[model samples]
Target: MLIDLHVHSDNSPCSCMSVAEILAEARSMGLDGVCVTDHDSLAVLAQIEEGFQPDGLLLLVGMEYSTPQGDYLVYGDVRSLPSGMDAYGLFSAIKERDCAVVAAHPFRAWRPSDIACVTCENVAAIEVRNGRNSLRDDRLAEKHAAINGLPRVAGSDAHCIHELGCFPTRFTVPVTSSSDLVRALKNGQCEPGEAFPLAVGL
Candidate 1:
């Protein structure tokens, strides 16, 4: 299954696209699924059913949680995961619940946190390729993941329709629920992939 695991809908303060528009665009782009990871909120989940799939295109809800350390792409139940905690604390919480966490755009130049600050044991993967990231940022993230022997994932980190599926992760097994997605990520059952026919190289 091909899934774009880092997308933002209008629920995110920074995104301009509505959930309907995001779903339409994902279908048009031939995506198998999209994780709506609105920043600091899971309000998108209220607007859709759990494991929502329209025409077999899944719409899974996650969150792009911001911390003083950096942003994290978090999967699984987030309602009880309180805000204002540092990244390390949040990662510990996620692990205790058997959920999953991925360091998001860790090497991005403008980000405040250092990748080295994120402990490897707590992370399920490193986002090696983000749609909005520069080549240098992605390369550095890739090298970090390689050095750490961590699983790598990718996503469009889309805030608008055009950006969806610019990068996606391919799962080796079928993923029907949020739990399944989390399991796939934690077990290294997925791999990063590029969008079809990119005008420029990834």
Candidate 2:
């Protein structure tokens, strides 16, 4: 199914969409589901409770965090990993808590961390198709994914609706919950895909 694993509502400093906007857009986009991973916050959870009109669009609750190393994608219940910790320290902490840890835009050249740091088993998957990522970043992500025995996942990292499906992940495994999503990621059951549904354009 077409599941977008990363998204941000206006709650994030970089985003402009309200939670309502995100849901409405998800309906318009014909998406099966989306993970609203606002940066370092779970405010979206409240939106779910207040009634998001699921419309069959599963809004998985998660939050993205900026670590000293770079961006960290986290799912499930857990407190912030605290700022200022290096990648290794952050990875160690994630392992201790057993949260699904994914390296966002892992190949961005200017980032503090490198391919070597992300090879650790603590990292659940290497993000290969970040919408905001450049061509160089994409190549590095794929190459690194092959090398480190890590599954390749993608994310639009969308802060806006236009950004939502620009580079989404495609999972053959049915997306039922957060656990299925995580399993698809770790088991390589998903594959990188084009930005949008190919049939729609024709």
Q: How many residue pairs clash in each candidate?
A: 0, 0
What digit string (tens of lDDT, one per residue) describes model 2 on residues 97-162? 536777788767644234566875767788887777787888888888887778878888887767
Q: In candidate 1, what are the lDDT values of residues 107-200, reduced to their tens digit?
A: 8865523586645687888898888888898898888888898899998988877777889898999998888999998889998975656515
Show model 2 residue runs off by greater than 4 Å: 50-53, 79-85, 96-98, 109-113, 197-202
lDDT of each: 0.82, 0.72
Instruction: Give the lDDT of residue 43 in candidate 1.
Output: 89
Worst 10 residues of 1 by lDDT: 110-119
Q: Relative to the unseen true structure, what is the Cα RMSD of model 1?
A: 1.7
For model 1, what is the error of residue 115's alpha carbon versus the real structure, in angstroms, after optimal superposition? Answer: 0.8
Listed in order, each prediction's TM-score against the native is 0.93, 0.84
